[model samples]
Structures are given as C-alpha cells and as structure tokens.
Target: MSSSGTGGSDYDVVISGASLAGSAAAILLARQGARVALLERRSDPEAYKVLCTHSLTACASPVLAELGLIPALEKAGAVRNEGRWYTRWGWIEPWAGPAGAELPYGYNIRRSTLDPLIRARAAQTPGVDLLLGHRVTGLVREAGRAHGVRAQTAEGEREIRARLVVGADGKDSEVAKLAALPVRRHDNGRFGYLAHFRNLPLRDGISHAWFLEPDMAYAFPNDDGVTVVAVLPDKKRLPAFKEDLEGSFSAFLRALPEAPDIDSAERITKITGTVDYPLLSRKPTAPGLALIGDAALTADPLWGVGCGWALQSASWLARAVGPAATGQGDLDASLTAYARTHRRRLRGHQYLAVDYAASRPFNPVERLVFSAAARDASVARHMHLFASRLIGPSRFLSPAALAKAAVVNLKHRRAAAR
Candidate 1:
C-alpha cells in the first residue's frame, strides 16, 4: 500500500466510502493482491449507518460467505429469516424453509452491527489500506479520465492516485458529481417510518410484509430478539402520521389484516422516518472510474434490497475488474464489463422497484400473481423465489410460471363461484 502523501499514486484502486460496498470491494481486491485504499468519513469503526432497514436477502449469502461474515454475524446473534410472508391477497406464506435446501437463509441485523463487521474485516485484509476520517473533496482527473481523489484528512489535505477510482460513496456521491455522470431519477411518493421493538409477537423465524393496497408495512425479526417494524404509506397519509407519529404508526400496523401484535410489544427505539427517498440510477462506469452499490443504483427501500445489493454489486465489480486490477487485463474493458454486468443483473429489478415507489395501487398482473400465490402452494413457492431475489424477474415471469399462475387463479375463481 502507498503512503497517503501529496500527489502519491499508490494503490491500484482508491475506493471512496467504507460502507458495505466500499469495504467489500476493498476486501475482494485485496484478496486478489491488488493494493486498495478504502476511505471513510467516519473515524470510529463501530459507527454505523442508522437510517436503513439492514436486511440482506438470500442473494447476498454467497457474497457474505466469501467475505467470511456469516460466522461472525451468527455469533453476534443475527437472525436467520427463513422466508418472507406477504399479506397481499391473503397471508401468502411460501415454503417454510430457506429458498432451497442449498441456499443459506436471508438475514436481518441492525446496520449498527453489520457495517462495522464488514469495515473491520476489510481493514484486516492484507493489501487494503483503510483510511478512516478521510473526506473526499474532489476528483483527480487527467485528460478527462478519473485517476484519483483529493481528500481532507485530520493531518492535512492529500491526493491519492490509483489506476481505478470507485465511487462507492453513495447516492449523493462526490465522485459522481465530479465525473458529471448522467443520472436517471424516479420520484418516490411514499414516506417511510420505522423503529425497533422488543418482544414483538411475531413468528420467530419469519419476516412478514403486508401489501395493504397503496400502503405497506413489515416486521422483521432481527438479532437479539429485536424486531424492526416499518411502515411505508403514500404521501397523502402524511398528515395523519405527522399528527401523531407513534399513535399513527401503531394504528397503521394494527390496520393490516392479520398483522403482528405490535401494540403489545415493547418499543425500544425512537421512531425515525424519511419523506424523500427518490430512486436514483447512474451510469456505473467511465474511463478510469466505476460506481458500485447505491452510487450505481438506489431503489425504494421498502423492498429491503439495499444492503443485499450493496454486497452483491461489490462482488460483481470485484469479479469483473479482478484481472485488470491485479495487472493482467485491460482496465477499460474490465470496467465496461462491470458496467454491463451491473445493468444486466439489476436494471429490471430497479425498474419494478421504482415503479412501485410511485405509491400507486397494484396493477392487474401483480394482482393475478399475488392472488395465485396466496391460493396455491406451488405458486407461493415460485413467488417466494422471486421475492427473495434468488431468481431474476425474467425467470419469475417466464411463460411456464405465468401459465401456472393463471391456471391457479382461474381454478380459485371457478371454485369460489361454485
């Protein structure tokens, strides 16, 4: 690793932001013997991102295992959420275990616990230089290609140069701003609020979500017997929530049919919320720069895909750029591969998530699928696979699955008529 000195071109990659994506990227690159500088604004390793629903879907299991995080997470009491139940048409429970016997279960743990774990692990990696309390001030560009960053640390200003600069900084990324990357944003019409509760009367191993038409609520059983309960209501309902945040929050949860007995649970944290969560998508790469995680794409948080995608995108970026970062391939081609891979894997998912962020009621196709899942065990399993993100949207909406969903719904309708 290169020393943080003036105009020092030290590392192979300078990754901004030491959150999930940044830290994960650092670890992966370092493991491949690429020198990495992982920078974070926060000095404390234990400090974590507070305003997030820190749920990781089954899709991230492999990445977590690769990073060697599962054992530590389990040791810290993180709950293994075997499956999710949706209250769309009715209580739609998928298969009772993991996505498959081979797949590891999804997990729910507070970011307070998760972020620090990832950061610490990354810091321990051999070729990684973890720079805490380093705030990026500007991009160091040469001939229109990003090569490094200008950052302000406690000692003084320093310039760290690299073959590649990764903007894992986040949605409001300084690198993205400096690079002037084209961004496409989608407006979100719903406001989200959540808090942690102790001893919530929910099933121990299952995460539950209620799709109450234009509104949504969830209760995820997490580490230490704490459940994270969140509600996303259309902006039109903001007045009621603002009038009485706790009362309204409780009322909303109680209003969900067959909801958990949240009112009976002990509230452990203050209610926190955000009204502006616009979905953001950006071009993932440029000549010498790449964006990963939320810097590349941010969708509605209601789906709890943020944490999972953060780790997944970092893994994708690492795999795509491994050869180049380790000095065996064309850097530009590797970045282009990463960009294409990012879009191919996440674009469709983001589109659907952003569309739902509009806070509109479910359309005909959603109704058909949800109704079928609620009625048929086989359909429920398929829906679970999609919801868990073990399969892509294309696979979930395949001809065979669609036909089965239609048949399941048709049979239910005919049986009801009788």
Candidate 2:
C-alpha cells in the first residue's frame, strides 16, 4: 500500500471502516483516478461481521453488476433468493426471475465470505491504498470543516489528510460522533436472534418469512447448503428466549402457521442475538466530510435492507462527489447535493422501516393491502416490488393501487361467502 506521512494531504479521499460501504467507495473513487486511503480497524483480511443476516436485496443487483462483483460472488456460491412473505391472511409470493427486464433475483451469502471478497477487491483497485489495523481516533477539523483523521495503528499514531473524508463506519460510528452531526433515533421494541443450520431443506432458492403480528421469523438459504434462520420477537418474550435459547428458537419456528421442519435440521453455529437495535438517521454530509451506509442511516434489521443500502449509498456518494474529489467541481456544493439526494431517496423507506421496528400489529391499511395481495396476482406483483425495495412507499401505496386492492378484497369476500 502507498504510504503518506502524517498530516500530509496526499490522498484525494480518506475513508474510515473498510468493510462494505468504505471499500465500495474506495474502489469507485480510485477507479475514477482519485487517490484513496481505505482504513480498516482489523488487520485480518478474513475478518467478517458475525452478527448480520447477510441477505442482499434485489435492489442491489444492478449496483453489484456495475462494480463487476456479481459474477465473482455467484462463482463463490452465493444463492439467488426469491421472496415469500407470509402475512396473517396468506402467503404472497411473486414470480421468480427478473422482476422486469432488468432486475435480477436477490442473493443470500454468509458474511464470513462476503466481507473478505469486498475488502480484497478494494485493496486491488488501482490508486487505492489499503491501510489495515488502523482505527480512527478522531477527526481533523480546520475552520469548521473536516479534512482528515487521526488514527492509531500498531506502529502508533498517524494523521492521514485528504480533500474529503468519508465515514462508512457502522451504527456506533466514531466519525459521526466526532463530527457532531445531528441525529434522530426511533425506538425498536423487537429483539433479534439468528443461527446457521445445516440439513435444512432448501425452498428452491426462495427465502421465507412469517409476519406473525408482534413477532417475525425468516429462513434464508445461503451458500454451501446452509440456511440462516432468524427470529425477531417482541421484547416481552425475551425472558423465555434467554432461558433456553436453542429450544425457544426452535419452538418459535415450529409454532408458525405453516412451520418449517427445523427441529429435524442440525444447527451449525451457536445462536447469537441483539436487543438494542434502535433506528438511527444521521445527516449524510458536512463541509469536507460525508457519511454512508449504517453510519448515515440504520433502520430495522427485520427488513434485511442494511447490506443493500450500504452498497447503494456508497454508489450514490461516489457518483455525487467523484468529480469534486478530482478537483473538477465545488466540493461543498457536491456534498450538499449528496445529502439532498440521500434524503429524497431514502426518507420514505426509513419511516416505514422504523415504524415496523416497533413490532406492532398491522394497521387497517396494511391488513387490507396485504390480504388483497395474497389473493390477487396483480396486487402481489406490486406488493413484491415495494417489499423488495424497488419501489418507494409513495408509489406502493398510491391511491389507484389502494383502490384496486380494496376492490379485489371485496370480490374475494363475495366469493368466500358463496
């Protein structure tokens, strides 16, 4: 890796936390001929985030294809996943394959394999200097604008200066804290637990989820014949889960309406869980600094949108500020543009995500729409697009669509009565 002395403004961009978002931004910026310093806290190249669902939604396929990583991921045994959502009414399964002519199916892969793949790609990109074992201690601010970072490494402290500093760090980001950006948080009332299991029957590349009001569970078929099973129960049920983790998880799955036979499957990993997952939304940009991925916005884990949003946000920032990093545009204007774009594209989605994080039963509108989707193929297609992140809340819950759903339900009720 190229070495820049402490406090030297040598690189165009310095990105902290080189996992998915940081690595992606580094690769894109470097490819655009901007010198980049990608700093990772962990020295081990194989290190991965252990507490993730690792499901990449269909919305990310285009971004992955553009980055030239999809083919490699598929070769490494990533599984394509079609979604099947089970509501209280019935199951809503969209047609498998491309949703339209362009979008490919979603994917499920273990993070143990995914993190290394992205990190290696970033390290190999031209003009990118990968600095492993470097943890950012603080931001370097001059005249109220961030220009670099003070990081600690095995060899002691060093300052890496750049024209732009990006915080692609996770939820508890030191960069965001040091920058003192405004933040908004929504309470999450659900706790999540997950484990990898072998010997579980595959659903032909389909992922399944049961939305049993105030509780939810999912099974995702991942690489190498392993399925990831997760349960998100209300906090009120925490005592039972804490008493017997494995038993409680199994019973929870078995108790679902059309339960999967997980009791016959052998778990390959120890169960892991988290209870303090509040939804966070941070301002995306400051003077010479920007935030992406979970550092900028983190919603509920139950939606499984984190991984895809990380890549998407990285792509957005790279596109928005690539020319500015290369000295062709106004940096401040570019940063403001990125912030506006991020908010415009994601605010609606975040609202719904945080609302669901409360683990409340479906509202009247949700019940009407979901039930109609289950009984009608046309409604199911529209609903699938929204659930897969291809469409926003406004488009999904449009007046025309809601009216059609109501009509479909009325017809279904008449048919049932006969």
Candidate 3:
C-alpha cells in the first residue's frame, strides 16, 4: 500500500486483473520460477463477474490436464457432459462416426466455484505475490517500453515494476487500455440473459444446447446442485425481457422447442443479462505487455467456449512468454510468439462462432447437414461431435462427409416434396 520510488518490486512479471486468465498465468509463471506480482482491483477475493454461462468445452481439457488443474477441477466437483442437441429438424446424436473420436466429453464448472479454486491455487504457488484490492490505474512506460504498472491502493498509489506486464483483465482490460491496443468490435445484434436453477429436468451430468433459428438456449449441469441456462436473442427483444425478467426468461425457455420445460422450475439465482458484444482478437502483445483471455479475444458465448479459451490462452501466454521475461529469449520474440500462437489456435473457432451468431436460419451447408441428420442417424452423430468442439471444422465438413450428407438430404427432400 506504499510506493517507495519510481522503480520497485523486482518481479519478473506483473499481471493485472487476477481472474481466471491472470491467476492461471501467475500459477504457470511462478511454476517456471518467475516472480509474478498479481494485481487485482477488487478487495474481495470472491468478487468475480457473474454474467457468463459457465460452460467449458472439451477443447480445453487437454490444456487443463497439462496444467495439473484437471484433478483439482474434478475434486471441486465438476460435472462431465456428453449430450445430444435438439434441433428444429431432430435430435442430433453424439458424434461416434468414423471421422470423430469417441470420448467422454466436457464439463459444466461454475465460475463461482472454479474461479476461487484456481485463484486459491495460484496464491499457494511459490513465486506469486497476490496483491488484492490494488487497482492498476496506469502503465509505467519508460523509453516506449512497459516497465510495470501504477496501481492505486487503499492508502495511496504505488508503482510496481517488472520485466513484463500481462493483462488478463478480461474484455475491458485496463492494461490494454493503457497500451492503446487496436480492437475490432462486432455487434452481434443480440443479448444474453443467464441464471441458475434447481429442479429443472436436466439430464444427469449432461448439458443440452438448443439451436433455435434466431434464438438459442443452453443448460449446463454444474456443482452445488445447480444448472445454468442462458437465453440468447436479438437485441430488439431486450425491452420485453427487461420489463419482466422472470416472465421473459420463462417465455424464452418455452419458445425453444429443443429446451426442456422449465416453466415451473424453481430459480436458484437471479436472472442476469448482458448486451450482445462480440470481440475478436485485438493486438494481443506490444513490447513488454500482453493481453490474455477476453482482453485478447472474445467470441460468442452460444458455443460455451469462453472459459475454456481463457484458461487455454493464459496457459499458452505463460508458456510462450514466461521464459523470455525471465531472460530465456528476446522479450519481443516471446510476446510475438504468444500473439501468433493465440491467433493461430483460436481464429478458426472464433470465425465459426461469429458466423453462427448472425442468427441466419441455417446456411445451405448447414441445411444439408441438418436435413441429412433428420433422415440419417449417423449424420446426426457427427453433427453432435462437431458442435461440441470435439473435432476440427475441416474434419466435420470433409468432402466425403458432405457428399454423404447431400445424398441423404436429397432423398429426404424428395420424400417431403412428394
């Protein structure tokens, strides 16, 4: 809570906003023997953003496994999920085709439960100095290089110096703000309202996503006897939703034919809503500062990929830049490497999420696939795996598979036309 001088605290890395991404980075950097100063604005360690749908796709499992957080996640009572999607045409079964691997998939770990767990683990790690309640108000730039950050504490303002500054401060990142990173924003013309419930007819350990034409809904079974449901609809509908939160939410749930009937289901938490704002990859790194998680890029949450991507990207940033910050490589090269890797790994997925967020009722390719799935069970299974992020998009849309889907769809169309 005190500032000694212009330069201080011989830390290797200073991480702003100690949420999931920041905490994960701190843990990994500390594990690599780098002293990390984690500065969080909130005094309360339990304080966290609650508007998220709280679902982690299987794509992030490998990263979690590598970080040794998988065991901790399981111990914290994460629920395993492998479920079917109810589309307008029919039920799309889980992918078990020749193209997709058969594996038990995914989890619905609530951030309220998972965030504190990861943060606590990060605090216990050897090289991390967790500085709670200190708000990073400015960046310290000397010779056009970020040496550290200036944070306002309870007593006064203090300058914390480090070799590198990592911004895991989420979508509206302050570090990114100070660095003047370029950002491209996309308005998806929709908003989301999410909350938890009890006594909903949720399949045990399985999550369900309903892909309605213009609107969407999802239910994730999580720890503490709670399940999360989010309603994503066009922004024009917000007024009605805002007028009566509970009634609008119930109506939205009932409108989704694929969703389970939750009209009479008891609410576990207050309904939360967020205006639709989709963010793509911004300038992730510059000199000695780098952005991780939503601060770097944020896709549509209809796919439930945000949390997984955050943890995964944080791990990637740590691995890519920690060594350089500790003098293992050129700091610029390390930051560039992290930026490149994050973009390469996530670009395709983000593009796909954006395409889906447009609210167009099934493009031609999707029509063929869904039509095929309605007629052929095998096709539905593959569609299921693809949606779950279990397989790459290329594999899901392979020429051979597309041809098979076309054949099946043609036959169904003829049958219906007759």
Candidate 4:
C-alpha cells in the first residue's frame, strides 16, 4: 500500500519482528484500516525462523482461514494433518465425522515456505510498511507507556512513531527487553530434536504422536512429500542423542508402532532444536504496547502449540486493538481486552504444557483417560479435543467426557476377564 495517508515512516501500529506473529498482526491490522510498520532484523526477505515446532493445531485453523492462507497453503502442497495419538494403552484414533462438515485440519508446512509467503502478504498489504533489516533498539515511552521505537537500519538509526507498539519478536524479544517487561521463566527439563525427511510417505497426510509417558515422538507430514520427525525425550536420555543424534533419533522412530520407513527416506535437513528453550510469559500488554506470539507466551514445544498460538494470538491482538489503532476507540481498553482474551484462552493450556515440560510422567487422570481413549472411539474423540487444544481442561474433564472414559474402562476390564 502507498504511504499517501499513512504518515510516512510513522503509523498506527509499529510491530517488531516479522515472523509469524508480526506478519499476522500487520496483515490483520492493515486489513482493518490501521497503518502498520512491520520491522525485521534480517535484510533478506526470505529469512525464516530456524528452530520451530512447525505444526499448527486445530486451534489455529480459524485464524488461518481468516488470513486467507488456506488457498495459498494448499497450492504450496501443505499437508492437511488429521492424525492419531499413541499412548502406552494403545492408539487413540478418532473416527471421521459427517460428510461435508468442516474438518478441523491444521497445516504442517515448513517455515522456509510459510514464512516468506506470509511476510510477502504483509508487505503487499494496503497499509503495512514492512521494513527489512530494521533492528528495534529501544521503545519510546513516557510515564511507563510505549509510543514508538528507535531502530537500527541500513543507512542509520530512525525513530518510527505509532499509537500501538507490538513485541512479536519471539522468545528473545528485544522490544520486551527494551521496555523492561518482567518475564516469568520456567525450566524445561527436556531437549528437543527435529529433522525433515524427503520421500517419506505419511499416508493420508496424517500426523502421528506417541506420548510415551515422559518422552514424546512425532512424524508429521509437511509439504512436498516431506515428513518431519521429532523426539522430545527426557534430559536423562540426552547422552545417546548427544553422541549420535541421527542414530538415536532414527532408533526411537523405528521402534514406534507402525513406524515410518525413515530408513528408506532421504534426510533433508540437519537435526536441530534447543535444549534450553525455557517456557516464558509476560503481561501481553502495557499502556500502548502489546506482545504477540512467543513474545507473549512461550510454551513447551512438546505440545506443538507454537505455530498455532502465534497465528491465533496475532488474530486476537488485531481484533482487540484494530479500532483503537485507527483512532476510532480507546487503545488502553483494547489492550485490556486482548489481555483478557489471552489469559482466558491460553492460561490453562500453558499451565498444562509447562507442567509437562518438567519431564514428569502422566498423572492419574491422564493415565485413566489415555487408556480409555485407546479402547473407545467416543473416549478417543474427547481426548483429541483436549490434546489438540480445541478444548481446555475444564471441558475435557466435564462429567460427560469423564463418564465416557469411565464406561470404556469398565467394559475393557470385563472383556479382559472374559
């Protein structure tokens, strides 16, 4: 979009970080007539985040649809992941629902493709000015309220003013840091390892998750016949992976039930991920500032919620602040609404994810429901709603859901005795 109406470098919204959340916030805000300045540290337009879960969940499907990415994703051969879960009890595979009903399928495309595509969309948007290689150096604030940012650019440093400033800069957020936003950090007790495979077929483009108590493994289909295999074993199992990452990773996958033939598949990407990815959270908003994506809430990768949360949170921020951003409403009230929405939808999910990140085994309730889900279709479906982040713990533990699990377990016991 031309800068005719949008005040040159200044805008209604100045969003730091140009990854998933930043690009999404820029796009959504711009769509609502809010002028946006999307700043990125990297000059190369194609730069993408290297370490990522790369699996968007059903919770993000609506936001993706709103972003008009479904068509582009499909055209890029993004895999529609509708999959099964594995527990010690057995597999929890939910049955397909009514014909023609909208399926809760999530995309599993690599960041290499998804990142640039979305960033380009943001750049081409009507009111967003995406600044490449603009490293945010500081926040312009008065009396504890953010107003704009000073950024280091190619020619020199520049100050970009805005009504709303967003920190979407991932786990290590410079905007949050410059603002001195206190973060609540939790220790994640396991290391994550992920790599992509070429020519590895995942039938029906279905993803697979094995919840092996404290350890986890996944084989998720991505675009172009590529499958991403990941393992998040307890730190106790680190020595083996450290010594031989490929061997250890492959051995773990090969041992799974109905395991993929990674032996025959060509390894495309190097095995990479972080061992020190601690869970992080902060107040998502202040006077004129807001944090989106990992900057707002960094959860354990074991849950595969990163991509979905990034997309969903960006949508939330945009909706919460769009009107105010364009001077039609109050900005602080918008921030408060976004904060409430963030806490309501994600607090419970993050609590569970961070708790599990400590390398703990399943509690009694988890074990009971997982075993029942393995045996009963209805139980499995209920579990899927929870595991996929489609429903929170409260709904997952509702009397109706627990009744199904209880009944399934009782029947299984009787059948075993017989």
Candidate 5:
C-alpha cells in the first residue's frame, strides 16, 4: 500500500483512470523512477469492468511479459490458450505445426479478477500512489498546456500537479470528453452480451469462438472453473431480445451449432447485454495528456481486442512518454510519436475488425479461404495464424495460398453442383 498524502508537487505524473492502462502507466513510470499518483473513481479495489470478456490475442503477450506481469498473472491463475475458431463451414483447430513456425498464443481471464490484482500490484510498487474514490472533475491547463487534474474525492476537491496526465478511463472516457479531443467514431449497428458460467465440458485451457453467419459468439474459459460467454448481433435484433433477455440469449447461443459445447456448461451469472454504441478513436494525445486503453480506441469487440490493446497501448505510451516526463525531450514531440506509433501498429488490426463488422454474411473471399482450410490441414494452420492475429491479411492472401484456395473452392463447388 505505497501512497502519499494530498497537496504536493512531488509526483511527476497524475493518471486520471486507475484501471488497466492507468495502473500500467503508473507502474511503468514509477519503475522508471518517476513519482506517480494513480486515481480511481471506485473506492473498492474489487470494482472493475464487468461487461468485458477479457481475451487477449497473441500480439499482446510479449507486451505483458515485458511489463513483468506474466508471473503475477500466472500466480493469479490465468490460463494460456492455444486458440480455437469455429465457423459454419468447419472448426479451425490450433495449429499442431512446429512451435517456432506457429504463432505465439495469448490467454484469457476475468477482468473483475485481473483488475484488482493489477491495482494491488501498483499499490505495492515504489513511487506509485493508488488513490481510490477520486473522480476527475476537470483538467488543469495553463496556456494550453496540461499542468494537473482537479478531482473530487470524499476529502473534497483536490488538485494533482504533475508533469503529465494519462487518461485510461475507457471508451466513454471522461478525460477525453473534458479535454475536447476530436474522437473518430464508427458504429457497426451491433451490440454485445456477456455472462459467466461454471462446470460443464470444454477442452482444458482452450477457448472457443463461433462465427455464425452475421452473429458472433465466444466462450472463454477462465480460472476457478469459470467461463465467459458472449454474443454479438446486429443492433436491429435488440427489440425482440429486450422482451425476453434470458430466453433470447439462450436461443441465440443454441442457434449456433458450435456454441452448444459452451451453452451446455452451467450458468453461474445472469446474462447481460450492452447496446452502447461501439466507438473507435483516432487521436489519443494532447500536449501534456494522453489516452490509453479503450479510452484511446475501442474496436469492434467481436474480435476481443480491447484487453490486449489496453496492455499494449499502455506499454507503448510508457515507453514513448517516459523520457519526456523525465525532461529529456519535448513533451508535444513525445505525444506525437506515441499517437503515430500506436496507429502504425494497430491500424491494420482495426481495419480488419471494422471490415468484418459490416452486416454482410461471410464474403466470397472469406468463404474460399475458410473452405480451403476446412479441407486441408496446411490451409487450416495458415488460417489459424491469420485469425489468431499472428499475421496480417496480406500474408494469408499470398499467391500460393490463393491458388490453393481456388483449387479447393472449385472442388467443393463441383461436388455441390453435381
């Protein structure tokens, strides 16, 4: 429980949100010898995002390991997944190829279970103060430069003066709103429902996701015999679902042939749905302020990209801004670099997610590739790498791969045409 009393310019950085990105920034900066004040709106350490499925793709595994969090996560009972994808055409199992050629994998855990653990770790780190129940009221700017943040806690109003302010407040970020940064938003007319279950059958440590026509469903096994189930459908179907939520969700799950393995599992929590408009962010930085996690960009959750990006963005921001905060470079220059690097690394993934969000059923190109994967083990391995986010779309569209897909598709069409 390392912390400091209010009313001091001793801290170098003041983070507005103390969840994933905020706490991560605090930890990283503090480890770099910068004093930090981490502010969390909720007083309870247990308070966290409940609507998340908490799945991370392979891209973020190294980032977490670099933060020295993998050991803590393992100790907290996180599970590594080899990845499993199920589609109407067929199931794409984990690639059993050479480990070196195979893409590195990621893991899944409950956010409610992971957040408190991270916050606790942040509190233990030297030079970091974990302030709970503190809500940011406004930004403190002088001559268009962020100097600090004004927050209200049970102790009344207080100001944290620091070299920088970090916003990890989530998709609907209050700091982003207050700062008046232009947020680019694209909606897919979709919504997501998530809940947890206990018991029932699932391959140990493997996660399952079903691509059902226009609908998407995922089942993630977490620690303590708990599994998270989520369903995402076009928003137009929400009205009927509202009338009978539980039944609607159950029916939706049952409708997916591949979802039954998860549906047959025990229900430990009531099903819940989120119809909030999914928003994607473009610029995540200001002169002396920066946004991280979903606060920076919220992609279509159908890909389960948020948790991983939160960690990745936090790590990237920490690296980009640490020197500036330490007075080695221009703050604005650092902020610009952070925004550019983030876009460069994440734009491809976001593009793919957005394209898939369109209401159209599987496109012809996707059908051809997936059909080939269903028939050939080599193709399935490639699709596994592509779907797991180990490789980009272009890599999967190489001349040889496309030629193979075309041949496989012709055979399937001939069999059906006959």
Candidate 6:
C-alpha cells in the first residue's frame, strides 16, 4: 500500500464482487470519505445468489440498522425472524432476555430480493462508483503488494488502480486466488437441497431448525408469504434424493417432528441442491489488500452464517481501513488491523462449524448443553445468544453457564423418576 497521500490512485479502494459484502464495504468506506469503486461481474443489477439460505442471524441486525437498511428491508417485504430449534431432546424455544427484554431478530429474505436492494444502496451512496459487468481478471501488484485490479468490462479491458484492493467475492474467489492467499479446505460430509414454497404454514416470523443428530432441516418463512424448506441429510441419504429430488426433499421435511404440511403448500421454485459443499478459509489480508465475506472464510451453509458474517465483516473492514484508504493513515497497519479483527471475531466460530460440517453426532458437551437448554429458558437464552452469533462459545460455555446446565439436567432427571 502507498505510504503517503492518495494522489496517484484512480480510487482509494476497489472492491470486487458488488454483492452483500462488497456493497456493504463500499457504502461504509465511502461514508467515511473514501473514494470507492465497486465492481460486479454480472451486468444485471438484479442478479442474485441462488444457492443460499438467506437467513441472516441476529448478529447482523445492528450492521443492517447502521447501514440504514432496516426500513428498506421491511418495506421490501422481508420477514423478521426469531429462531427456534428442535434437537433430539426437545425444542429450544426463542427466549426473551431478562426483565422482559426482547431478543434480537434477523431478516429472512431471498437473495433475489436482498442482493439488488443492497447493491442499489451502494450505488446510491456518495463516493462509491458501482461498476456492473466489471469482471476482475488480475491483481495489480507492486513490491509484493496488491494495488488494484485488471478488469474486463463491457467495452475493452481496463486497469483500475487504487491504494487498497478488497475482495468481497464468494467462496471461489478470483481475488483470493490471484493474491495466492493460503486456504485451508475441509470437506462436508452431508449434502443440501433447498426450495421455496407458498402457503407453507411455518410459525409466523420464526425460523425453525431441527438438529436430528447427523441430519439437519429448516423452514424459513421469507418475504411475500413464501417459505423456504431445506434439508442437509448425511451422504447415505443422497441415493434417495437422487432417485426423486422433490419426493425425497418433501419426505425429509415431512418426517421431522412438528413438521410443516408440505402437501398443502405450493412449490414456488424448482428443487436446487449441491452434494459437495465444503468449508474454505483463506488468509484474509496481504500487504495492500483485504478479503471480506466468504472470500475470507466459508463455513457450512446449514448454520446460516454467511449473510450475517458478510455484513459484519464488511463493517469491520470499513472501520479498520477507512482512515488509511482515505490517505490519512498507514495502509499496512490498517490491513493488519482488519486481519486481526476478522480472525478474532470468526476463527473460534468457524472451528466449531467446520467440525460439525463433518456430519458427526454431537459430542458429550453439546448433548448436555443442548438438552438442558430445551428444558430451561435461562439455558435456552444463552444458547440462542451463542447460536445467533451475538455471543461466542467461550461465554456460552462459561463455568457458570455449564454449572447451571448441570443443575437443570439433574433436576429434570430427578423429576423423570416420578
């Protein structure tokens, strides 16, 4: 990164993939007075990621609010969701916090709706140039640091120069690949199938998750009276899905306890699935560049963490590098700060998520805690906090929390003797 004034740059920051993370980062950085170029490979502003659950967790609520997106999202018919989970033991209901405090709720909207809305916001924000049909071809590097990107546009090719480059692209990131960032790969043992339904009567404004040992399923009620039903069954179940995609998917959901009535609901979208989803974590930063969203880390999609983390990571990147990108501070130090923040906030969560993606049964600790949470509202509140990404495992597994869980389980066991 340049160590002095930002006079020689076409822009202060050039962000690749003007989707959730890129647009959020561009809006945030430009708000802080940095000139930003937001590039998207797709020409249509309406293009969206189809292979997503689009369930933003509670942790991302504040960032959306900060971006002034709450009203727009609501106006666009996005659903607000508090979460409920069913385990082998029982249901862990969404708990109201102490003293009648409401739990944080997240948005449940399809990427088809969210992607274009967020991108439009970025385009409307001052200081951000939203470039569509701009596919990143190569990184502009000097002295072992990325300075910008070479992009293929509607016209001829162009070289976009900036003081700092940002990769907010998805898992198969061209920027991360071009930067030669080290990546660790972890394969998922289970596969997923997803579709939308109309008139599927899920609980109003609630997202339901069933952790049926090695398998998982969800019913997310989304915008415009539509509901999303998905299943992530172990590989052994793949044969059934392969035989009949719609039948197998409906069967999986219908078999769950308190399952929605799929028979009565209208299937709104064709069944879409992937058998080989994997976890990928890339080194998030180099000398003059930083990566955000799935480019930084891709966790198992079953957990529904991608959209939430995209907004959070974009916020963190903007906060860390805003001054430096505007030529008011050292870019290297800013990049380091962004990297540290990314790892600190997400590494622990990713470790646990990757372990679960193996399609293994829950370990002893998880069994104890989850069972206890189903029986006790206090325990459930803490569990929701942790699962929603508002709190990390350290706090969720704190000595006091575990001790309380043990007591709750003991009391349940004693009562069962009657």
Top candidate by lDDT:
6
- In model 5, the clashing pairs are none
Which residue runs of candidate 5 sit more than 4 Å off their true CA positions? 1-10, 98-103, 203-205, 261-264, 393-404, 407-418
Give each model's whole-structure lDDT: 0.85, 0.87, 0.80, 0.86, 0.79, 0.91
How many residue pairs in model 6 have overlapping backbones?
0
Q: Write the per-residue lDDT of candidate 2 for residues 149-213, one digit (tens) a residue.
A: 99999999999989899999899988999999999999999999999988687455468888889
Listed in order, each prediction's TM-score against the native is 0.95, 0.95, 0.91, 0.95, 0.91, 0.97
Q: Best by TM-score, which number?
A: 6
Quote the positional error of residue 95 for candidate 4 in Å.
3.2
Q: Residue 352 in candidate 1 has what lDDT? A: 90
Across residues 92-160, which tens digit of lDDT does each residue of candidate 5 receive? 665655666655677787888788877888899999999999999998887786778999999899988
Q: What alpha-carbon RMSD in Å does predicted model 2 have with respect to the real structure?
A: 3.1
For model 2, state the Cα shift of residue 114 in Å.
0.9
lDDT of 1 by residue, 10-79 (tens): 8889999999999999999989878999999888988788778779888888999999999999998898
Residue pair clashes in candidate 3: none
Q: How much does each candidate deviate from the true structure in C-alpha RMSD?
A: 3.0, 3.1, 3.9, 3.1, 4.0, 1.4
Q: Write the per-residue lDDT of candidate 3 for residues 1-418, one digit (tens) a residue.
A: 1111223447889999887888988998888878999988998877776878677777778767766788887888888766667777776666435665675466778888887877888888999999998999998887787889999999899999988888988888888989999987766767898888876786544777777777778888888768888888877677888888889888888777646657667787888778757756688998788998899998787777788788888888888877676766677878888989887877777777778777767888887887687678678777766666667678888998899999998787798899
What lDDT, from 0 to 1, does candidate 2 have? 0.87
Cα lDDT of candidate 1 equals 0.85
Model 6 Cα lDDT, one tens digit per residue, 1-418? 3473446889999999999999999999999999999999999999999999888888999999999999999998888777789998888985644777787778899899999999999999999999999999999888788878999988989999999899999999999999999999999999999999998877655789999989999999889888888899999888867998867887888899999888989998999989998999999999888999999999899999999999999999999989889888888888888899999999999999988888989998899899999999889988888888999878888899989999999999999997
Clashes of each: 0, 0, 0, 0, 0, 0
Error of 4 at 205 (Å): 4.1
Residue pair clashes in candidate 2: none
